[model samples]
Target: MKGLKKKRKWIILGAAAAAVVLISIIGASMNGAEVESAVVDKGQVIKLIKESGTVEAENTVVIAAKNSGEIRKVLVEEGDRVTAGSKLMESEVTSAQMDIKSLQSDLAGLQAQYNQAKNLADKNKTLYEQGALSYEDYNASNTAAKQLSAQISSLSYTIKSYEESSGAAGVTAPINGTVTEVFIKAGETVTAGASLFEISDLSNIYVKVDLIAEDADLVQVGDPVKVYNEDAGFTDENCKVRKIHVKAQEKMSDLGINQKRVTIEIALSQSTALRLGSNLDIEISVDQRENAVRVSDKAVFELENKDYVYVVSDGKAVLREVELGLEGEDFIEVLSGLEEGDVIILSPEDEIQEGTKVKV
Candidate 1:
């Protein structure tokens, strides 16, 4: 019994010495490595759908060439402001002008022929009444005069039509707005119905974004949007969702993924700084949490389909499972396993293990 008791005492001493050595090694390890870390803090976490969009006019009108002709001169350029009835461009002597001259010349020739026919008809009428000419001959002379008169009238009507069509050579603005696009240049021959210009009242414009089907469903009309464009000095929060398209369009993504996207329009209450067709970034808050404990997304990682984060505690890395909530562009909400003021490792490496010693 005495020997057994001595053996038990020695065993306890040996175990204690081993524990001391282990602790020393752990202490050395804790002081050896350095890591970057951040403290968990409370702030607003907004779930936003980020998208790039284009500035577009609410009411864009495409002006087309009124007549097929060579453009003589363009009076207005892009960005020029004009009022109704302002001449946007003028066409050189067009085919219609030539047609008008030809019709007038034909009418003059017909008028001279009618004058000769009428003179013969009157002479034939006098001879026929005096019983010196046949009835058939007199009737033929009268018919010739009437036919020439009809031809002259018809030619005059055609000349009037050609004259009216020639007025289209001078293209004018139908509305008061700024020219946003100019498709025609001087000396370019364009066919009728070809695009000439695009004009719009740019005082009010809207931003158009194509959101995926899932994100589109989360947004509603009247939801406020934030528009950002650093180069254009446009950072506006007064824009609101105006329209959401009912149908989705199939588009190919940059990664070659097929996606169904729906178009949405955001109306800007004041948009003087944004130019038409300029690209801008937009953010719409689909969900938000106020005063929520959040951490940088870089600090959180995934393992075995579970979310985890490395927490700094007692100069050691403590692997903790985190229940994530709302995720934003920069930060993510931590519903559990984290607290305010708790320091966490940022971008923990793959080799970082639980209970590993670390220095912040």
Candidate 2:
């Protein structure tokens, strides 16, 4: 109570100063207690988490060779628009063709043996039924026929598979997109799994941002985000929080503070008109309130770790404790102890006591 009284005493004195002629040269009245008051009003308040990150190509598709061989021809060049399954390049297929021919010959030989075994098995079955061949011999002949058939079928599939793969060495586009890069040239040797072309659709780009671990959990997929390039005056409202990475990485801030950051992926519109890998400022909208009662930060003074503002009522300053919600750079959310149209002293000068009278 004593501390509160002392704070009011200082504030009242400051109010008396507001009336004095610090600007007496301007012909201000020195007798009237001059003070400034603002009518509390309701406005929109939004909680935004801001971060900076770079735009990257999303859904980039890589075209690779199916076989390790020399590039016979490059059908499509870089920057070419291609559809799915469009041939990008042809690989050297001479060796693959020869391998398939050898398998085919082996398959033919196995088929002939299988036919002979089947004929023998049939004869043995008839002989055994007529009591001329033993049961054991009949079963052996049948088993031999079945084994030959199995070998022939297996070899035939192998030959068919080889034939199919002989054409696979020709690299094709896996998706419809613009080719951003081509890694193989005519007569250049490229191994399987080696990237021969890189294609990007550019229909949708993503801005990869990192947020602190705590903030990451607050934002979710499908939340709207704003991205802006100040120099270019470009902004995209269609950007949405597409993904929040589960892994958190440790990063050092400009202040050298260690922060656990989780990467967030947001999709931006194709209209940014900027190249991939460009950097931009982004703000993620976490929460919003419409027509929320707000007061200027200058008016809310802290006392005992609490916020208090003075409202003038009937020629007296009424001290009221306020519950604040969002602390903005210019104004704060007034959750309680204030209402619309109520007049509060703007940065209530120190030394203004409760019940003190001042002219607005």
For each candidate, what TM-score against the reference? 0.68, 0.58
Q: Cα lDDT for residue 178, model 1?
A: 94
Tens digit per residue, CA lDDT, model 1, 239-326: 8899999999999887899999999999886647577899999998777889999999999999899999999888888989999999
- The runs of at least 3 residues in candidate 1 whose Cα sits more than 4 Å from the true structure, single-residue gaps closed, are 1-32, 92-169, 251-259, 269-271
Writing each residue's lDDT as its tens digit, candidate 2 over 1-360 gives: 999999999999998887674666244333334678888899977778888988777779876666677888889887788998787876665677777777778888888998999999999999999999999999999999999889888887777676556554356677888888888789888766787889988766778998999989889898889889999788886789989998999999889999999999988755655676788999888877678898888899989998899998887789999999886646788999999999999877765778777678
The local lDDT score (0 to 100) that residue 184 gets in candidate 2 is: 74
Looking at model 2, residue 65 earns an lDDT score of 60
Candidate closest to the true structure, highest TM-score: 1
Worst 10 residues of 2 by lDDT: 25-34
Residue 78 local lDDT, model 1:
91
Q: Highest lDDT, which number?
A: 1
Clashes of each: 0, 8
Task: Show pairs that collide, candidate 2.
Answer: 10-350, 10-351, 11-350, 11-351, 11-352, 12-351, 12-352, 13-351
Model 1, poorest ten-residue lDDT window?
160-169
